[model samples]
Target: MTGDQTRKLALVRNEVDLSEGDFDPTLLAVRVEEAARRLSIGRTTMYALIRDGAVQTVPIGRSRRVPVQALSDYLAQRMQSRPINAVA
Candidate 1:
């Protein structure tokens, strides 16, 4: 990752205050931008994922929030579909 991306990831990690694992149980949901940062994806790509149903979100007032579990699920599904030993 580039320096800027690393810095951003650090910022996101600090903001989320992750404990012993990849996610913090206390944080049930996060803003779209935060979710994007957590996934190391651009905002547009994140939105595209949502649009494509690869990622899920919840409506909150006038804003949309991505559930922390949704992120985990997305990652798990992706890993399942593309195994580490699979050829490109």
Candidate 2:
């Protein structure tokens, strides 16, 4: 990775460490890898979700970012579709 990329990755890592609950929605978006971290998934899975249109992303120049709302929306959709079990 170039210096800029390295710096961005470091920033992502720091963001991941600082905000354990959720990202700040006031900010536009986070890097794909950072979004993956927030979702507790791997980068490959995040990319696949993006490719499959399961997660929404914004394109800024050559970089793609996942909005904080998109992550929350994706999790909400998953939770809504999940089946709940009841014990007798």
Candidate 3:
């Protein structure tokens, strides 16, 4: 990855302060790769989820940006549907 990509990945993985709130202006929407990294998943899998409507994306001009809320909602739905007592 280029330095810029690495920096973005780092931002996705570590920069956010969870205690503050979810509405960070800088993170309102992030690149697909950043969203995937935030969710600890592969970029291809993130795109698949987007294509399947399990996750949401917003188009800005010609680029696709994944809303931070969408990722949270998708994870919430997945957690809700997970089988209780399933092996961790």
Q: Pick the candidate with the highest lDDT.
A: 1
> Residue 80: error of model 1 in Å?
0.3
Q: Write the per-residue lDDT of candidate 3 for residues 1-88, one digit (tens) a residue.
A: 9986776666666564443434234668887877887787898999999999999999988988899999899989988898977675
lDDT of 1 by residue, 29-52 (tens): 887877887888899999999999
Cα error, residue 56 of model 1, in Å, equals 0.6
In candidate 2, stretches whose alpha carbon ends up further than 4 angstroms from where it belongs are 1-25, 86-88
Candidate 2 lDDT score relative to the true structure = 0.79
Candidate 1 local Cα displacement, residue 1, angstroms: 39
- State the C-alpha lDDT per candidate: 0.81, 0.79, 0.79
For 55-80, candidate 2 gives per-residue lDDT tens digits of 99999788888988899999999887
lDDT of 3 at 46: 91
Error of 1 at 18 (Å): 12
